[model samples]
Target chain A: MAIEKVEYWRWTESNWKNPDIPDWHGSLITAGVDIGSTSTQAVILADGVPYAYSNMRTGSNSPDSAISAINWAMKDTGLTLEDITYTIGTGYGRVNVPFSNKTVTEITCHAKGANYIYGPTVRTILDMGGQDCKAIHCDEKGTVTSFMMNDKCAAGTGRGMEVIANLLAVSVEDIGELSFKVDEEPAPVSSTCVIFAKSEATKLMRSGWTKEKVLAAYCHAMALRVVRLLERNGMELDFAITGGIAKNVGVTRRIENIMGIKALTPTMDTQIAGALGAALIAKELVEKKRAKEG
Target chain B: MIANYGYEDGSGHYYIKIDTSKCAECTAKGCISACPEKLFATELDDFDDEVVLIKEDARNTLQTNCARCKANGEKEPCRQACESDAISFSW
Candidate 1:
């Protein structure tokens, strides 16, 4: 029998303009660019409020990806690079953002982003990005108090999910919902390494395990792996999840079940957290500079 | 078994190298407990010998994770804890 192919997890790229943005004829136009491994994002702030933002796939060139994301964000807005008073670069390709005024680690940016997205009450953040995962503890203001990151392994990351998507001919976006259609939660795959897990999944397929069953196993394993990282960082209340994995209900629900805490629902795209945080930081830097100059 | 942890960006290259040749002789595995960030773990290598390895997630962010040790101008806890002198940082 021929296996059918489906592209469920391919989320559409979006550029958004906040309807409530105020007229800022003389306000500082700050921006943040997050050049991640798999996706790039740019967020623009009018003074300290979000104005516009874009999220897209990162290309082979980091500098080009940063510029492309920023241009897309500014496309609908009557803005240009010169209009941005300060720019902060963040994520894996952070240092490569040629036009940025400074670079901030993704950890700090994610904390700040979580604070803005979920409100200042959020104290814990779990950012599951393409190539890595971060568990962060922060103050009410989104200042990182402690953080732990897992970048070396792909097991609990978006990339790992993509690998499974290709293997099962399922859409990356669809894996989460499909994973839950099974009669019961299958045992998690034994390996924590993506490469090894792939082999284990193939073995399960040979044994007549259904695609949803295999996916359920993988999603459970991914959630469990991330929880280990979160436990190491120490769990705090008001937990929020950022990055692409936040949209995967299969993994997010599993994570909530394991942790016994529900994650705050984000009003905006979860992927924008890093860039939004960077933009907020840009605003702070520009204001500090102005105060010092005065 | 030389394992490297770090990434190369426009600014520069940052990595932490752990030589498993030296790690094979370690009986204390102090690096696993000494790293405040808990970036080390003991695992069985391909040859079926147990060795202390730096968690893969910790490799790319060594500069950021090891900042506290560097800022204090003190010997890195992981390096100091290693009796085999297997760990080194390249910033």
Candidate 2:
């Protein structure tokens, strides 16, 4: 018998290229690849404008994941790796990006990317990635003044959401909408820890609590954990959310309700912010090098 | 002004807060060489005041970098080097 494959927590892997700008001739092409713990995103920029990008699940090997992401992003775009003037690697696996010219911290990349994606007004950013959550404060130019991460816990991270999605037998993409189906918000679970939260969910299930209610409870707890991180780091106006969790309406809505501030909407996929920031930085680095050479 | 470095996580809080007001008065800047892990550095901050700060790259790796100090039962060499009470750690 073959091993059963689980698709519950599997979000779609995809690539996007701007159809409006099909040509990249004479443009300074740059690429940024963000190798996160759970997902990898590769973004290609042409003359400082986003040209192509890919978001995919990270593989077991970080280097290999980096390669796959860039290739997928450039698929049929007529751009090769050598065409890129510079490449910056970022995120949890930043050091493992074999083809990058430099590496940057996810904290810096997120702030820069948010400014671009959500506009220059974005001063506060909350990024809940695969295995960690970070809150960042940036200036008008996207310079990071301060930041903090939920470094030691999976409580407010995407990994915790995946586990719950798997246990609830709901597609991770659909779970957020399902969570709101509950008639009234259930009280948050007793524990913010993922392991303990899982056990609490099990107990709730045994007590005949609906899956939707349990999901609401869990998302509420997760949002609270995220709020604490943001408050500690200091939140500013024109806030935005990035990473996998940003796409989860359940978590984002709850966060807004608690903080009394609406998160800015991005025209592009929020998950690509880190990689986008890297690509933008790659462009900057190339210009700096050119100036030095002259 | 107090500048807090490092982070709080699931396990516990780990921070190295530097009182820049006190740091501004110190010309010796001894903390730069005191850390065994070379985690400290000096730079002119936003106010153009020279002060000791944790290396930017070193901030995220404090848990591992400070482990050696804890293992040897010599908790903080950097704090001891700061004669002006400018450096402190939250563990």
Candidate 3:
């Protein structure tokens, strides 16, 4: 069957507001904007607590995407750009956030965000983003101790999965479930490159291979690719995954099984880890300024 | 034969340039072990010589993966290890 021209991997945008946040009428408000290659996230914090957040697809302009994300986050909260005491930008477009007071690397931000969501015990973080993957080791306070990243290749990232979804005409969200329906776990694709894998998948399809089997092969390859990165950095306990791929059960399950350890479940949307961490940093910066002034 | 690794994105341009001529003369491939992120490997180039090159998976992420060294004002480990002065970063 010929695949239709559709963005099968485009996930829905979402926004959330923490109900427990007390009124921030006079309190410090901070925001973090993470403009990733494929998505943008904005997180608002009121006195260092998560107040509101928005996740959306990134558009052509990095600065514009950052602004749009933050605006969407602030929409229902009755907050505006002027209300923010500080702003920190992170992710691939950290330097492009025009309004940010500071910019933090996504590594540091992801560590801090994982600490907040998974608790301070999280020592290992694997963030599988749209175009890259990162294996980060952090201290109890979420300060990065060591880290490695894979961005030159697209084989083991969310983009890789999207390629497969487009090829198979399957929804990206359903690829995980469909991959498990195969009678047996197929051997992973031979190539570690996404381009080669796509060609290989095409050959398999032409040879009468089922879509489920092809998906299983691709997912397994992605899991193994990430496992190599994690092992190179020396995996520690209290591991967590923070990124779009964290929602993929197929890849996550295989990673857990291969490592013989379970990842800590995130309490919030995984994609917001970097932005949330940036917001937390913004709060700290604001408090530091206040103390200096006082 | 210069090899450039990295990509241009909305944020900025990040590239790691390797002078293959300098690399061709080097007998010891120290860069492969010098990088903590294991971003380097040896490959046979068109000249049929074993030269050190940045791994394909690390090209686009040079700035991020090298943050520690960059922030500390320390020379990049790979560049420091290359006695031939073959590796240079464009951040």
Instruction: Report the poorest 10 consecutive residues by lDDT, candidate 1 chain A.
Output: A3-12
lDDT of 1: 0.86
Residue-wise lDDT of candidate 1 within A32-143, one digit each (tens)?
9999998999999997888999999998999999999999999878899999999999999998999999888787799898999999989888999999888878898888
Worst 10 residues of 3 chain B by lDDT: B1-10
Per-model root-mean-square deviation over C-alphas: 10.8, 4.6, 10.5
lDDT of 2 by residue, A205-265 (tens): 9999999999999999999889987887688899999999999999999999999999999
Which segments of model 3 are wrong by more than 4 Å?
A1-5, B1-91
lDDT of 3 by residue, A77-155 (tens): 8888999989999998888999999888787799889999999999999999998988888889887766667675688
Sorting all predicted structures by DockQ, with the top scorer first, yields: 2, 3, 1
Residue A73 error, candidate 3, Å: 0.4
Error of 1 at A25 (Å): 3.4
Instruction: List the DockQ of the predictions in order.
Output: 0.07, 0.22, 0.08
Least well predicted 10-residue stretch by lDDT in candidate 1 chain B: B4-13
Ranking by lDDT: 2, 1, 3
